[model samples]
Target: MSEPTPLQTLFDTLPQSGSVEWIGIRPARGEAMKALNNVMISRGTGLEGDRFKGRETSKRQVTLIQKEHLYVIAACLHREAISPDVFRRNIVVSGLNLLALKGKTFRIGGVVLEYTGLCHPCSKMETTLGPGGYNATRGHGGITARVVEGGELALGDNVQACS
Candidate 1:
């Protein structure tokens, strides 16, 4: 029998780009909040809110990931403000599964990041992108993370995931 791979080591060890693409952030329902150096507030939910075990509160926090998860290549063509259906993450990442980044710790430009949980889609997506927004691709929009060690993050930043 082979030993299972550690959850912390899910992604390949290759130094890849698009692991941390910083897309433009806009207001979805309220006034545009200032992007703080260590705190950029974002919102998300789980599939049917099940990820939260039926909690009604929408998950909102700062998002983060490893350098390999940025997905800059994709962001350049699609742009950060593109339709919500696509992985239009305010910060499009690559290596790590944004949905599965929960509870993990990573680093971005020397700042420590703490993975929270999956960022499931919500009604706004359906309303904005139509029923197609409810498709499998849009099921869980992505995941959310908090900047434990806040710092200045910009496009093309090299993020590092630490266990």
Candidate 2:
């Protein structure tokens, strides 16, 4: 076979295995999401209790951000570190680059999730992160995912490539 592309090589190696540092599920729009130690997920239910649950048309079944990216975003705005909740992502992992999982499948605890695309920053980030919050979080917005398998995801779960 021909040599793999740089990204394909990284995908094959995946030297970075990380843990799920935080989890959040929003029950409804315009409301604060619930931070939890564990949450159930499935292809049909997405993240249990999440407002986006059962929305077949939606590809944004879950959202993830890297814990280290929080600092990067803060520095971009000349502000202190922000919490995962401020970004409204479902999971915050440390170590692995969320972008690396694009077009790949990964497991968080027992759940299988496929990276769909980048989780771009929304206008709410401006209000939540302050004047420059939205812009600061632009590239650090993290990744979006869709559940492919049903299982329980807990805090400190080992997240790694499926194969």
Candidate 3:
């Protein structure tokens, strides 16, 4: 095999580490998210209790958002603050640029995950976050991921790129 190009090397090197700030699971579609300190991540099934029932190869087994983006979205909507649950993502991570994880596999505590695609804001944002909510979350919607290895993940668990 040939050596990796400069860009590949750059993408592979992620020195910054992040931590899980919050975890949420929805028992069913359109239901309110239930926050938790920790939960079991299962291969093929995603979060143990999440409404998601995708196959093992499904790209959107789990959804995540950056904690910092919440502030940006709030500011865009002229709000004092925004809660993570309103985004309907499964995880809220901080201290890392989640975009950097695109096409990469990372670990959350003992669980490993591979980035799949961007988690775009849905129409529900308009009603849940008020007017202009959809536009406010346009680029801040974060990414979707599929489980690579299953294990326990908890609030405050270290999140880092896989070597």
Error of 2 at 11 (Å): 3.6
Ten-residue segment with the worst summed lDDT in candidate 1? 45-54
Worst window of 10 by summed lDDT in candidate 3: 43-52
For candidate 2, the clash count comes to 0
Candidate 1 per-residue lDDT over residues 19-91, each given as its tens digit: 4554444345333322222322212322111112212243344433332322332343343434322433445
C-alpha lDDT of residue 126 in model 1: 52
For candidate 2, the per-residue lDDT at 73 reads 95
Number of clashes recorded per candidate? 20, 0, 0
Residue range 1-163, candidate 3, lDDT tens digits: 9999999999888999999999999999778999999999998899989998889999999899999999999999989899999999999999999999988999999899999999999999999998899999999999999999999999999999897
lDDT (CA) for every model shown?
0.44, 0.87, 0.95
* Candidate 1 TM-score over all chains jointly: 0.55
lDDT of 3: 0.95
Instruction: Evaluate candidate 2 by giving its C-alpha RMSD to the native, one decimal.
Output: 1.7
> How far off is residue 140 in model 3, in Å?
0.6
lDDT for residue 115 in candidate 3, whole number 0-100: 94
Once fitted onto the true fold, the runs of candidate 1 whose alpha carbons sit more than 4 angstroms away are 1-18, 27-59, 64-88, 137-140
Task: Give all candidate RMSDs, comma-separated.
Answer: 8.1, 1.7, 1.1
